[model samples]
Target: MATLSAGGQQDAACMHIRELTMNACKVAHSAAGAVAEGIATGVNALLETVRPREIELDRLDREIDSAVTTHITGATEESAREMLACMKLSIGMERIGDLLLGFSNRALVAASRCEMEDVRDLTLMASRLEKMLSEVREAFEMRNLDKALAVLRSDAEIDRLRNLVFVRHLENPGGTHRSESFHVVFMTQALERAGDHVKNMAEEVCHLVSGQSVRHLLRSIDKPLEQMFLDQLRTKHAL
Candidate 1:
């Protein structure tokens, strides 16, 4: 093998970091998919899909920590930025994995008790979370800012699903409460928190590839859909 130059070595290190980060992301995305599948199918499917993967996510997290520690020592400025982004991405993915596992645990107990509407809302939340993770991965791989923005926009739907679930469970006008309402609310919150982490990843991707925050990028955008999202976000935050 030829001796590699310092820059070549850094490039190789950055690639390793990116790959590790992507692996963690995939596991997180898988966890979200498991939640949807579990809620849709049954507990057996959830156990098969979710139980063993937490260990895998933990292993990936450790490997990413090692990669960042080993690679950042002599990295050039650009490479260091890339490594930091990888580090941030891995952190978010790990948290998402944990949240999804918790969601699965709640789902395992909640499945038999859940009504059709409960199942419907929770499954939709999981599906949206999975989509957000998918788009974030695509954005990272392609350095596509639009995909990242799409992930950001998709989060609004997840939040809306969450609010709908809460209103049905907590504020039911009929004054009827289901026994599984607690579990349903917890599961919704778990998926919503996971979406928040995914949103963070999307924002990180925006900053990583463009050197600007998502808000700054939105400010310069002229697209109607994106502008609508920004306005709604502003209105929501104002409330």
Candidate 2:
């Protein structure tokens, strides 16, 4: 066997980190897809997809741990930055998965019984969330601040769609059930939370590219969409 030189070992480790980052991104995308599939098919299919994907994500997380352990020692400044950024990105992705799982059970029940328009609204929301996942992936891949900002901007639309769902549900009243309104709430909240997590990953991209936090960078100087969402939310809570 040929003995590897010290420099060659470092190169291999950096490559491993890159691979782990790619796998982490794939896991996030898969989680988004699970919601889409669940909406298109039913809860059972969504549940199946989520369970296996979680196993894959757990496997990748372990691999990242092992790689970080082996090669992170005495790394150069640039390589260290890459490792740390990728680690944060992996975490953001994992949390997105967890958030998606949080409301899946309730969403499954709601999906089966909600009105066609409500279902349509939710399907649109899920598509938007999935697109955010794609943009966040691109932003990280290219280290592009613009793409990340776009992801940030997209959050407003997610909030808008969520509001639409709430307004329609409120107008109709007990469309699902009294207690089961929570089901609709969970589904919408899942989209909003998913968008927030995607925004977190986008902020990570901003930091990696600019060495500054853009988390507070004029994302919402004004209430986006309209005052209607807050109005809807207040009215719903009041009743």
1-239: candidate 2 lDDT, tens digit per residue: 99778777877787788788887787778777777767766666774576566667667766776787778897777777777777777777766777667656667556677666666666777778888888888887888877887787777788888887776656655465433455777788877887888878788888778777673443433444234345545787999
Give lDDT tens digits, candidate 1, residues 1-239: 88989889989989999998888888888888887887887765764677667778888888888888998999998889888998888888888878888888777776877999889888898998989999999999999988998888888899999999899989987888577888888889988998999999999999999998777777767555556778767888999
Model 2 root mean square deviation, Cα atoms: 7.1
For each candidate, what TM-score against the reference?
A: 0.91, 0.78
Please list the C-alpha lDDT of all candidates, in the order they appear: 0.86, 0.73
Deviation in Å, model 2, residue 213 alpha carbon: 2.1
TM-score of 1: 0.91
lDDT of 2: 0.73
**Residue 34 displacement in candidate 2 (angstroms):** 2.9
How badly does each model clash, as a count of residue pairs? 0, 0
Stretches off by above 4 angstroms in model 2 are: 41-43, 167-179, 215-239
RMSD of 1: 4.3
Model 1: lDDT of residue 82: 86
